[model samples]
Target: MGTIDQTTYTLTCPQCLQTEKKKVLDKGSNYGGSHWQEGVDFSEFDVAWAGGGTSEPVITTAVCKKCNVPPSIVSSYS
Candidate 1:
């Protein structure tokens, strides 16, 4: 099983070398129910747990704020 996490990324563009911050929310789990399971795949059964959105694997339109890259696709921004 994979653990879901919400993360903020500070991305630096190689072309323009401008850094920008973005938020990507991934809700791994939720609280509540008749009882909270310690270790279970609640998302499989609950609609509330569903649609824990994830960040895009690639963002191709990220523009550098400084020099502005020509729509460089983002592999990873740290």
Candidate 2:
């Protein structure tokens, strides 16, 4: 099989209002519990593992050319 280069979005934290890039994996697998089966597919599940409760704007450091803000002053709001 050919190797594929996966791309990811470096997300920032929304709470503290800091601009930091985060690297995330593309694919992941999770095992079921007693009430659930081991081989059961968790794709249908809508569970939030981490960084789920973000209520702020995303980092604007890499803003598009259409925006008026400068890249240096741009901030990532999670």
Best by TM-score: 1
Per residue, candidate 2 scores C-alpha lDDT tens digits across 9-46 of 33223333334333222222334211211111112121
Task: Score candidate 1 by lDDT.
Answer: 0.35
The residue-by-residue lDDT of candidate 1 on 1-78, one tens digit each, is 233443344556676555555444433445521221221121111111222233233232344445545333323322
Candidate 1: which stretches are off by over 4 Å? 1-4, 28-57, 70-78
lDDT of predicted model 2: 0.26
User: lDDT of model 1 at residue 27?
Assistant: 36
Compute the lDDT of residue 17 as modeled in candidate 2. 34
Q: How far is candidate 2 from the true structure (C-alpha RMSD, Å)?
A: 15.0
RMSD of each: 12.7, 15.0
Those runs of model 2 whose alpha carbons end farther than 4 Å from true positions after fitting are 18-78
